[model samples]
Target: MNVQPPEAYATYKTYSAQLLAWDSSFSAFMSLKSHALTALQIRGAALLKIHHTTATIMGRCVPDPTDPRSIVTAANDPLIFSQSTNDFQTVVSLSQSLVAAAEQDIQRGNGRLAGGLTFSTDMGVVAPLYYVCIKCTDVPLREQAIELLGRCPRREGMWDSVLGVRMIREFWGMEEVHRQLRQGMVKLVLEDDGRWEWSWRDLHNGGEGGGVGYGVKEMLESQI
Candidate 1:
């Protein structure tokens, strides 16, 4: 995808600030009422997560002076990197809180809504937890997200916790293989250019533009 224009960055910053302001106002309102609504809290945290994740990605963009949308590169600025890390930390915390809140809600529901068969049109905890499971760099936090996904098997819109957990565990296995390759624990045949060609054939075998065909549970078990 092409890089966003300079104006896009400015717009993003404005939106982020507005989101923060709204969250602060909501918090103050809740404090005054001496009660916190779980649904509203979840919605607020999810919105912040979306904004922060976008900010983290945008922080890596270094737009070209001549054509802002045509050229981009990873930023080398320490402050930008710090801000990205802080944003990611916020995502992690929000994901954890969402999972805890969902678990409590499930408990209070008395097992009526704990299974994968339960469905909801409104946004729920599954997507946020899945996002953290796939995006967070912190191992423990990712594991916690995955574990929660496995335990709570509800369906939120099109998001299924069971399938999400499977995908996340598959992702974990892929990350593990990449880490081993980087550490030289995996043998590799390098080309003349000293680059190893990694193929996705083993992961997906429905020919070009095909979805993953293997079962995630089987893949993870083989890794074990």
Candidate 2:
């Protein structure tokens, strides 16, 4: 059903230049994934795309001793797209390297990053509870964290993005963190001018950030 994957793989093998040309398109596609887009994922994809593109274009324009033209040539080959070829194997190795780097970057940022943590396994449903809290008592970090939450929740890999409702209840007892997060949400709403989607816009704009009618004002009242 998905012919794109094979085509992408082939593009990686022979005409690396062709693949390089598609870099912007590929990035746009990746961005549409939303919350699933991680800093590391973005970085790795950029690095991979640029490396391949540069190699292809340079190979045509000028020769370089440091570049691995063989790998680039193999990755951009057209035959590999029709059938799995040795070029795919080379691409696979490169992919593995990128994945490793991405993982390392995530760990460095998340501190105690657990690939994917789950609580219950009933019906194969794992609780969604992704978070992006910073250990700072300043406006910048807090504000940035709020913005991060607003954007990140729309992504794919995040638990909050996927299973926030189920996970929120689990953290009900942690008032301090919960309150801070609530404030962050409020900031998101105010910053967005309350004109976004009250239910999910992360702003007062009436997206998802408004809560179920009670609103941030009512939420604070009830909490206190």
Candidate 3:
């Protein structure tokens, strides 16, 4: 449930209906819904996963000034899995902070790290979506988000990542982006190049300077 603290979850649950209320106003505005994953949602999720991973990695490593140990290590130190009183709190806090950092890093030019507008080194890079677009601006994304705000035809249908990829290709004319999302497509340039999923995983693991994607080096060179 997004790694929130126990209390936060309880509090969040109190307003659960309000938190995700999709009434007539929403449905009226979102009449053009598709059964497939929209381009924005698909790319957004993939990028979100990357950003979440980055936040978790960075947040855990943000040494507690009061304590010498890192959060993850500290969490593991107290007990097998946070049986200690303060251990769990620290873990939960760091997780929440990382998530916030990731969101700020993406939606705005957060100064805490290499913001959306900056080309931070791999180690300092937080979110890849900002870096991926190279042309990402706040206004367009905000509008896009508001436009896509609606329940999918079904929850499980959202897993098909190719929908948004196709949309990206069709609307934005991003052929390579579509190719990357559709892992099964054979590489036009390399005979031995298998599915994009393997290459993407390799790129993801390599972290920064693994530069080279869709004929654009800057697009995919993220810190994490």
Candidate 4:
């Protein structure tokens, strides 16, 4: 839990590589224990591999504080954003696979639980899907992830998928407003005391007017 960033990155990378090797060996091993293992178990292994892959990609976003050469901040780091987008794509695929496998189990009456609620002490899909919603550059992929979250009424320890969906939706709205502000479709007004307020440009009204809003600075700062 107290691992240094570099060590954590290396550990995640090792986990990803080892999972790949294990996957390659699974066919031969399954031949001997095909009856012993269920399809869900196989899919679970794949889900674990996806988690490791996600961690490895996330690790790349952490800059080493001790390295002077690692001076590029995340705000301007193209590599970090690119890796995040890749992570989103990978997570979405694995999530779909896992959902399909679970649905199959339900149809065959192998599903363990009943009703719309599920509880698990272990970490589950919510966190990664939430990450995709916030970090992924692709709007459609982010929306897809949110849609997936909405389908599951579950709790993985402290994570609530329903709450996550609400938060992501709010985040999307905020991001759209920020985009509009950047494009000058919305305008921010600086008060005399250095506080920032915002208003719509009122393009239809033919005047630089709208109801003034407070906390614009706070909203912009949160994004930073």
Candidate 5:
């Protein structure tokens, strides 16, 4: 709470670099310690959604004095909880902490860059774009996310555009995509030729585990 003026900025810079480098390797670094990352994801998601939907979220949110330590402990340790007593402040500080922790892991160096958001690398590469998308609240962060998606590297047959679209759609109403997919007469599918095509499915049969492809059917079906 009483960080020296220079210490916060220095810390931010250090962590920012780490956040930029998170990749497939990240998962391994977190293999036995993934509860920390999971906590970050859950807390980050809640705070980002609140900010995105309302255009504002309290800079801090005081935990109920009676709130169970187990719940709060998942996201903010006692140290963080004591310092960031507001929603917005907590979100920002947590972002910094996550980045710092990730960078430290990478500095120790030992992972692979195969898949997922936390890919590892022998090199010091980073993926700040994803961090901004999931963290930061200002206009610049949104712009950065859009720009990064446009230029993100591809793997196998999957492209950043596909994942980018998913992220964008999430910012909008996720349920709306499902509703449209169900009611619409046509479903979109990717062809062997790498072309997108449409198919007809019965809406009545559409839903979780019901339609042809409705597992996380709500989100994935939108691509159709």
Candidate 6:
């Protein structure tokens, strides 16, 4: 339960460049790496409903003196469970470790460019943004995520605004919320394409983690 200095963010772009320049191919070595990546993904999703705090997760959870390897309930609050003896810290550390490993990919090198947020170079790239925002209470990490994204006009998409409206409608199943979504909210930001727009960062990233677009539907439909 002692605090240690956090590991420095490691994305050695230079070393990655060197590795790629080598003439001898490492395709045989890469097969194991590929398998590991797939395994990690399988393992990650195995944790049920990580978006909700009370959900049970599958990972290196807290060590209990009573039951060292037994399944223990981890509270939903990542900030609370992040204490040294809890599961949140272990999960966060493992996530950062993945980022460190992906930093070694010289080809494309997008993982390194993703600012220690992603492992593979794809849609999952934005996962680190969701992680630090939820797990760690570090302001710098959140800033780093936004900075790495850079500035873009209309950064958040129409999907989010509609989802927000849907959320309001779902909650309490109130007629007022339905009226607002139909009249106030939707009319406030209708574009030429007849779609509502949003400019907020999506904390619950359904697109990357969830199977469908933004996973808002899934989250809503979930028993949580």
Please report the candidate that would top lDDT against the real structure: 4
Report the number of clashing residue pairs per model. 1, 33, 3, 0, 20, 2
- Clashing residue pairs found in predicted model 3: 38-164, 39-164, 122-223
Q: State TM-scores per candidate.
A: 0.57, 0.21, 0.18, 0.66, 0.25, 0.24
- Model 2 — which ten-residue stretch has the worst lDDT? 123-132
Predicted model with the maximum TM-score: 4
Residue 148 in model 5: lDDT: 39
lDDT of each: 0.58, 0.38, 0.34, 0.68, 0.41, 0.34
Clashes of 6: 2
> Taking the tens digit of each residue's C-alpha lDDT, what string does model 5 give over 1-224?
22235564566556545543542344455565546566446434433433332222212222333445543443333343244224434333444443444445455562121223342332111223333344344444445444534433332222244465467647644434445557674466765655654444556777432455332322133232
What is candidate 6's lDDT per residue for 49-121, written digit by digit as tens? 1222222221223333343233333323343434422333334444444344444543356543432332232
List per-candidate RMSD values in Å.
Answer: 10.2, 20.9, 20.1, 6.4, 18.2, 19.3
Better of 2 and 5 by TM-score: 5
By TM-score, rank the candidates, best first: 4, 1, 5, 6, 2, 3
- Candidate 2 structure quality by residue, lDDT tens digits, 107-128: 6775223222222222111111
In model 5, what is the error at residue 144, expressed in angstroms? 2.0
How far off is residue 55 in model 1, in Å?
8.6
Once superposed on the true structure, which residue ranges of model 4 sit more than 4 Å away at CA?
Answer: 1-37, 64-79, 104-109, 113-117, 189-197, 202-224
The lowest-lDDT stretch of 10 consecutive residues in candidate 3 is: 148-157
Per-residue CA lDDT of model 1 for 5-25, tens digit only, reads: 679778767766776676677
Give the winner by TM-score: 2 or 4. 4
Residue pairs in candidate 4 whose N, alpha carbon or C atoms collide under 3 angstroms: none
Ranking 3 against 4 by lDDT, winner: 4
